[model samples]
Target: MPHSGPSASGDVTGAGKLDRDVLKVAAVVVLGSIMAILDTTVVNVALQELTVRFQTSFATIQWVSTGYMLALAAVIPVTGWASDRFGTKRLYLVALSVFLLGSVLAGLSWNIETLIGFRVLQGLGGGMLMPAGMTLLTRAAGPQRVGQVMALLGVPMLLGPIGGPILGGWLVDTVSWRWIFFINVPIGLVALVATTVFLPQDEPERADRFDFPGMLMLSPGLALLLYGVANVPGAGGVSRPEVWLPAGLGAVLVAGFVLRATRIPNPLIDLGLFRDRTFSVAVLAMAFFSVSFFGVMLLFPSYFLLVRGESALSAGLLMAPQGIGAMLTMPVAGKLADRIGPGRVILPGIVAIAAGLALFAGVGAGTAYWQLLAALFVVGLGVGAAMMPIMVAALRTLRHREVARASTATNIIQQMSGAIGSAVMSIILAGVLAAKFGVPTSQGQLAAGAALADPATHDAAAAAAADSFGTAFTWGLVFMVVSAVPAALLLRKAPLRDELVPDVVDVPVGKTVV
Candidate 1:
């Protein structure tokens, strides 16, 4: 559907005024974003408890994570269409309601399969919330406050991942893992009510035809690719047909989606957006950063728990310093991006990230607690500074109509990159372990059990894991460095115009243009 002028009826915030009501609406939108972001990591600390509850193998339980991620990938691309077809306010409310229902179902799930199914339901709604929230907030703020709004909105987004493990760990220890899902209920309800009361019912004038074929190709392609990566730890490398086949097919399907999108009117993704050099660079940089940062984040927790013999609660505690560092830096970095441009902010941010990864590479089973915290703090600083700038930079030249699509694309890429990074790191770690000790059972059980048995074996296994992790981190550092170079070179030296400029027509000699 095509959006009319900014003041068209049903606009979320009424024309041209920044009033208390608008702020209230924006606050509600941020709450919705928080709900989505929190779910991303809330399950991390509960994996062990879930494993026991499900009575499933580690390989099988891991699907709970993989399934949610796949569902997120599948649903994200369709959000722009959904919001446009249904009014923004209407869709936002529906999405939140669906997410709430999913959370309720998850808490009451009878088996691992049902729990995973519910998680997918949760992901479906969650996958749209951030982009939808951004749409509402940006349209309401009217561009002058994009920086401030993004900075404010980022607080919960940054806090969620950091807090998720801590919160989940505490819940599992103090109550039950079900509480983690249950916690979303009240927050979701609040957001839903606030959205209904505050959000404007902006419906687009003309509805575009849905591109079912494009979605069919892209969604499963992404899901299969991520699924393949998630299974790599247990399934081995390219040598394992099961590992390679799905990944290969996914790649082919994605290529087909790209080709099809280029020829279609109102494609699922407007590939032409990549024509803008700054947007292209920003997207690429974001993708690489996600690979490096999320790969480390996903691995570090397990490393502490398995290698250092820390309890899940202790592991969560150890990760707190990193979150603190990120929290400390994001607002300042966000403001800096506003003042000096994202290029300036991102360049140094990537450098810090690389430095942090280098420090992480030095960590071992015998590393001191303070040293681990220090490494994490450094990494968090890099993450804090890098992410917001990448987001703001990509949207700097975009119009209000384009923001949802752009945000969705950025998120999909980040998720896919993280999945790939996790897979690659897992493969490296698994192979190193097998070579150091021996191959586990066909299901990868023996390797897991051996690491749990003797301290010597555990330490040896950890060293091998650390070595592989270090190698991946080094590559991640290189990716950060390389990504920063292009971003620094391509991004605008100064901020672009903050307002959404309409497409203007060129008037030629003796020509009348609308």
Candidate 2:
């Protein structure tokens, strides 16, 4: 059913009339968005600390991060339904409360297993918060202001990823690793209160039965697939039974979901949305960029600390420049996107990212620190500029009723792609290390350790690791270059203003974009 309002393009009340209310609601929603995004990378800086504190193997400790990602992937498909069944405001508050509770428990965990469980809990809440927040923001702003709202929301979303490691590293060095989780408490509390008080409650529409079967098929399928992919490289490739079983099962289940969705009236994902050429292309571009961007972001901190011998705090500080570069350029990019077209802005941004990654690929063990900073800054600028445009273009043609579903789809794709990207990078890096240095089998382990105990051997191993990282960065550049092609070709060339303002339609159920 459509909403009861003037046509999406009609001026029921001028923009100024509800500007304050929209801004206030946006503030609350952006806060939740930031918290959700921060959790994605917050634990990255603490991985070394967690490994030491738990006295666990590196592979075991990796689950702390991987599990959260899998849980996030599992929960995202349900957001559109959840928001409809329970009102958006109600669901937002609940998600925030659950997130806060999970954070508190995570901080108090007794062991690695407990911490991983709590992280999953946090991811569950976080997965909902992101899509829900975008749903609310897009609805509140209407089609006219989608770009503006997205631009505002993007600040925290971009900042969170860039800032998480920096903040986490600072807390771990100065305070304790627990503080990384604890920091979300105050922010979540403020967002919860503001949401309850400020957010408008739209009347609920009657809906078809919830798609439980689709959920069963899609959720576990993605979770298991991601789990298998994440474990493959670490398990010494796909030849292992452990890798193939889950991956094969996941593939079959996903195929099952596609078959089931076709038979259902209202599938959980509304896969029909992909029928639109622009929407399909936008989603593809978003996913491709996410794979390359996230893959590189996940690699950086480890490279700094493990390869460069930088302390966690220093590494975080070095990473800060990227955020600074992004912050400096985002507003200008957003305005330019509004004036010209997202495609024009985004294409250049993609090229800049490719250039930055190419520069990073040249870094050696003895490279100057300034060169590293310069490369990161360029990448940050590119990401900051490109992201808003991609989002704006994706939602450009969506009707108000489908906006939530569209946003949810975009969020899920990005998350899944990021997870896959991280796993791919991890495998590539690990494989390079193993192939170059030889596997640490029984005899090899003894010899490698003996060599490492001597300064001469340690230096050789360190050089090999550094060289492997440079090679990984080269691969990363290749990924970015390949991703840029589709983005340039598929994105529409129309100006943002023309895209935002749709023709007025007179439909009975509220005026929606036609």
Candidate 3:
């Protein structure tokens, strides 16, 4: 049934006027998503404080973040099936409640172990929010309005990294670190209430028998893979058996799952979504882009603190321009993609990102804040322009029934690619430092930073650190440019409703396509 709101004329064709129901649903989903994304980044800034308060080693305290990430990876694959077996509205509420409960428990934790345990619980809920919420929002908006809706949703994600550290630092310094977790309570509760009141109820689809074998293969594969990659920077490189063992095993399992999924009648995730040219190419582009984007996010803070001797707060403040630039461009990019096509916008966006990274490569330790800010802002603008448009392009080619699988696949690719990118950049940085300082990889960062601070060694340290960072930034630049290869393959125009027809499923004689 069409929503109750009266349709009116607007700029976009199929989405001539915004639907009231779509807006309401988008608001609820965006609220929940913002909470989840912010929590992911926010905790990083509090790790040191947590270690001091708990009187624990960095390794133990690290579990607070690591455990959450692993749990998120483990749970993400099952969400597509879960949403199908249950229903979107029900699943969304349950996920929100789970996260809220975890937040409360985490804030109340008396020990590091308990805190880590609660973080896992939080991740279980968070892992479901993105894909499931995407499914709900995309279905409601339809392909035509997906561009606009995705732009609206991208706001929190773009801001999360920028806002997380600043908020987390302030809370840790002024209030208690517990407030970092506690802050989610009000936001989550409001989202739950809004979702219950504004979102329409969705009927559960016919549930397929759960694919136990596929789950075993895919879940552990992703968890192990992400765990391995996430440990790269701290592990000093992928050379350690600790890093490569799980990664290898995870790759084998993932391969097994892919092979099995292709043969099975009802797989946990539908691999067939890749058959669409637009969907496949967009996924490829996003994955490649993520490697550059997430890598730079890691590199920027370290460059400011270790290279330039800036405080955590100062570094966070410096990063704001990127977020500001993204905010300025994303909505406009979305409208343009809806009007013209994603390809046109994505190509330029990719170029802009490369240009920004190139600028970062040329900067010295003494580079002024305004110059660094300009480069970061350009990168952010490219990120904002490209990310949502690519997502919309992928979704635009899918039918309503396929939204869940598409959502799950895209989210998984993005998370995996981001983790890989971060690991790769860290590994590169480590190698560069090792070569430049001629010291043990683990001690290189400390030595380099110390040299920068000690005026006697300032020149040598600055040069070595600058060279190492510049090299890393160059690779990130290269990745962004490489992404444009697939971006060029994107559909030249926004897919029309007629071109996005659902694939016909075989049914009993005389039955219609559902």
Please give, for residues 302-356, the per-residue lDDT of candidate 3 as tens digits: 6776677665566667778888888878878988987888888998889888888
Candidate 2, residue 337: Cα displacement in angstroms equals: 3.9
**Quick one: best lDDT, which candidate?**
3
Q: Clashes in model 1: which pairs?
A: none
lDDT by residue (tens digit), candidate 1, 340-458: 78888888878877887777676665777787788788878877888878878887776555665666667676776776555455445544545555664132323643575666676
Name the weakest run of 10 consecutive residues (lDDT summed) in model 3.
505-514
Lowest lDDT block of 10, candidate 1: 505-514
The local lDDT score (0 to 100) that residue 250 gets in candidate 2 is 90
- Show the colliding residue pairs in model 2: 3-510
Q: What is the TM-score of each candidate against the true structure?
A: 0.82, 0.83, 0.77
Which residue ranges in model 2 land beyond 4 Å of their true spot?
1-14, 17-27, 54-63, 134-154, 193-205, 338-340, 395-404, 435-458, 491-514
Give me the overall lDDT of model 3. Answer: 0.75
Per-model CA lDDT versus the true structure = 0.70, 0.71, 0.75
Model 1 clash tally, residue pairs: 0
State candidate 2's TM-score: 0.83
Ordered from best to worst TM-score, the candidate numbers read 2, 1, 3
